[model samples]
Target: MRRCGPAAYPQPIRRCASCADGDRSLRTVTGIFLALGIGAATGLGLTAASVGRGTGAGVLHIGPWLATPKAGTTEADPYARAVTARLGTLPLALADGLALTAEADDGGQRLDGRCTYRVSGQMPPARFWTLGVVGEDYEPAAPAGQRRAFTSYEVLRQADLPIDVVIAATARPGNWLPSGGAAQIRLILRLYDTPIATTISTSTGLPAITRVACS
Candidate 1:
């Protein structure tokens, strides 16, 4: 009876409101992804910058000269000059009494320690040793989540035995160290006052990094 103005011309036209909404949602999602990408890039950039400023990455030596420190010498009286002179060469072997292998991969001198320290040798009888994660600045790194620095001296033990120290994180109070699958760690094997001691000569060995992780 009555004719609609535009509808009467030909066919009916349906409104695409849902389609418009979908487009808007897509735009919102794209914006979110972009923001996330930017944040990730910024974080990576900071990490790289920090690494550059630290000793985490540098020319690596498999081992250093003079493996052990003097038995009676104290930290106050360091043998720095004597140690520096010895590190001129590379892959320095521990004296006959000791054995050590760089747990890190050769040519992988980022100072990112990802492997377990395998120290196999006759440890000194009366001496106590420790291994700790130190920063490239030669200080203790900040506490990381779920894991702390592991050392043989810190381990809660009942009886003394031949020391086979593996520096890793652990929650339980026992001999075993729980590695948190960290990206890196400095496997510092230390020997206290003993007849046959192995010392990481000052200004030698591997450098340290600040950002340490358990996993």
Candidate 2:
């Protein structure tokens, strides 16, 4: 009988270089696909978020107020159309009215319920105009008893002086409009039967919102 030595044991099977390289290549390909998929998902999420916030193109800025000139017209952009659809609010046609909105105070800080603001300015010629405080949801910030709006006909103004309206969560002494406990607020200035052009111009007069105090 032949004596069995260490060399007689079967040598362990070793992987070929080609097979090892193929495995590494497959892993690299899988990693690339995963990275691409993650990137695509992140991009989609950011786009959706921007649209929801109304960060659309083609916005017109007149002073501190902003409006989409084509919002209520046949030439409305996709973002304007989407906003109108989502809010379900009827935008005034160019011929009937002009609506301007402000979300920040003159200091460039967001309008907050915790702060009092004074909206003061002179409006251009218009048959009628109304200024009101609305919540972030575009609804009346306060109940009717709280006086949410001020109309040109009812507001007190001095000769050749700008009108002033105060907005606060609590009662103020003059021209008070309630904030309705909302953390964030927006101001809407609607001019009805106005001759102002649909396009915003530097001469367009809009109100200035100045922060007075905060709680």
Candidate 3:
């Protein structure tokens, strides 16, 4: 019988006392079980930590940039990196509330094929909209197949008319712009230099980006 102590005691060389076996097989089995459990716990802890960090430090989520990941995009939430704010403009410009949102890359889905986003919002009469792509560093994430403008032109319905714009990328081009398989795309909806009558009373809405599968 090996004496195990409170201070750096040597492990017991005892066999299975209940099984009446003098072999060290039971000790080996117990050691293997303990090692597996520890490994599993460590792995789970690291995964949880990664998720927590990603949520706290990354992603843009707000008005113009409200977006979700496409189907089959990621096992985890890829939108964690898309954080939204009324940025790039001043308080006066955003007085009516800056509606902005950004969508991060679904790993590499956008690069493999075409992606479509249906953006709908109830904007002010003087409002305008543009959909642009940006890279991981927040710069323009331009795809190789098409050219894009910095901002969009006038996208209004009519005076006294509610606005609902559907933005998408077309292989043939009806009116939407091209996605170019960008690393990330941000939809910017802005009500230009005017006072909104109903800043607090108006509504804003848009659909998530839907990735079109490659043919």
Candidate 4:
């Protein structure tokens, strides 16, 4: 027989090389799948966060307040529609009325029920207006048998002076609005038959909410 050495084992060596190539191909496929899965999850998470923050396009910023002019109307944006559906609350149309809401004080501090706030400023010109405190769920907040809302007709205003309304869990002296022991509070200022809706580019003269104290 001819002298056969390493060449006699050529078949075994070829089989090992094929096995290595197969393993590398499987690893590459697995890595691609993992990358795709991670990308999809990250995209979904960001979308949910944006919706929760309510930071949508075409929002009207009046001082420290925010409003969607097209909300609850035939021209409502997708974000406005989502918000209405989620909150299950009716929003006034631009023609009939406008609703402005604030979740933070004038100083950009988040409104907390444990803290007291003083809302004071020149009232926007309107036929009728109402200011109310509501919980996160948009329901009226009545704490300790206190009222949740105050109307422009009822709030005491001094001539040539701005209106002042106090928001607290306890009783306040003038224009008292209760927080109802809620962890978070939202101030809704609704203006009915207001010219402000027509001239949104101009300053709305909306009131400011200032934090006074926290217990």
Candidate 5:
């Protein structure tokens, strides 16, 4: 009878091969999971960045301030609509009003609650206007029972001068809006029954924000 030396170890050899295949399969599964994890993390990061960026294809920039003229109308881009929906706030239609927001000063520095700012300049003609510090998502960021917002009638502007408003954690004379000691702030201006939503390109009168001091 043949010794069958090599074949005698057939069982062990087959086991070894099986083990090798199992290892490779495990590695493949791990690689697939890693790829999926990386893709998910990247996607989430992009979405978060897009939300706070406050921008869309129809963005309007005046100095460091920015606005989306069609953000509230049916003409709003997909990104704008998604953002508003996520914020759970309803935007007025173009026929009703135009809205603008500024998160930075004219010098292009992000507005800090620790610092004081002055918003001044000529504004477009509107039947009514309101200015105030809103939350990151444009929600009212004031203490309940306190001043929730400011309207054109509420601001005390200097006669014979352009509109000037002070934003600070502390109070100051003339058109003052408290910053509420938050880390960051955003300014929103709404113009009711204004043509600037469609005529911004030719509208020269716009507001400017100037950083005054910091704590």
Candidate 6:
């Protein structure tokens, strides 16, 4: 056998100390970039979620309902403005009306679409009002297609009695706003030309959501 020192083959095997160090450096750089990309994505996701669901820390907290009274005006908070822009919501003016969002029932349970709910009680003083399940909050477009609402004018009511609205996927007796078979849903109460628009302090009261049954 012939004695061979370093050059055994024709080409030189480049496994020097510097080469190992360079490979380690490349790996470190790649890991850092990957970390940065993941962090960026996470941050953006959090921001979108935050904008989609405004926190109660900055807006009104009426039991389970939440709202930004000044969201339609220039005086709206930055977060509210961001939310409005993202949702593409044309909120009613502060002088015209106010909108309240309810994500949970009176028992502090998240409003599930598969279950039936009863919205009862007197509404704030307003010239006109509407109650319906909106698309954004939990966006219920799964089991139902036609999006509809119950208006104060058309909703069946007895002689000056408190109204009872039913939220369910199937048909109901009186006032029925479709909830579809969605996993979750949001109830929006819009009062047009309401006293609560101006005097939110004496906001009469909001409706109560009680879970009736589940399918």
Q: Which candidate is the best by TM-score?
A: 4
Q: Each candidate's root-mean-square deviation in Å?
A: 15.7, 3.6, 12.5, 3.6, 3.8, 4.8
Worst 10 residues of 4 by lDDT: 49-58
Assess each prediction's global lDDT (C-alpha) against the native.
0.41, 0.82, 0.42, 0.82, 0.78, 0.80
Tens digit per residue, CA lDDT, model 4, 1-215: 88888777755535678899999999999999999999999977876665555577656766568888888578888777776776687889787888888888888888898899999988878888999998888888775466878897888988768889999988888788888768898899999998877676536577888999998
* Candidates 1 and 2, the one with greater lDDT: 2
| Candidate ordering by TM-score (highest first) | 4, 5, 2, 6, 3, 1
Model 5 weakest lDDT span, ten residues long: 6-15
Model 4 compared with the native: what TM-score? 0.80
Please, what are the lDDT tens digits per residue for candidate 1 over residues 1-215? 99679767887677699998999999999999999999999977765553332222222233421232321234312232233233331222223222222334233443343434333334344345554554443334335553334444565544644434444444333443434435543344444443343533343333222223323
Model 6's C-alpha root-mean-square deviation from the true structure amounts to: 4.8
Q: Where does candidate 1 clash, by residue pair?
A: 68-199, 136-208, 136-209, 169-178, 180-214
Predicted candidate 5 versus true structure: per-residue lDDT over 1-215, tens digit per residue: 86867668745524578899999999999999999999999988886677567654566667776777777877888777766777677787888888777888989898887789888888788889998787665666666665656887777766646788888888787677888767788888889999776777623568889999998
Error of 2 at 1 (Å): 4.6
Whole-structure CA lDDT of model 5: 0.78
Model 1 TM-score (2 dp)? 0.33
- Model 2 agreement with the true structure over 22-47: per-residue lDDT tens digits: 99999999999999999999977775
**What TM-score fits each model?**
0.33, 0.77, 0.39, 0.80, 0.79, 0.73
Candidate 3 Cα outliers beyond 4 Å, as residue runs: 1-99, 104-113, 143-146, 150-170, 194-203, 206-215
Local accuracy of candidate 6 as per-residue lDDT tens digits, 1-215: 99896677688567889989999999999999999999999978887777666662347778888878888888887777776777577878988899888888988898888899999887788899988785444354334455477889988888578889999888888788888767878888889998787667524578789999987
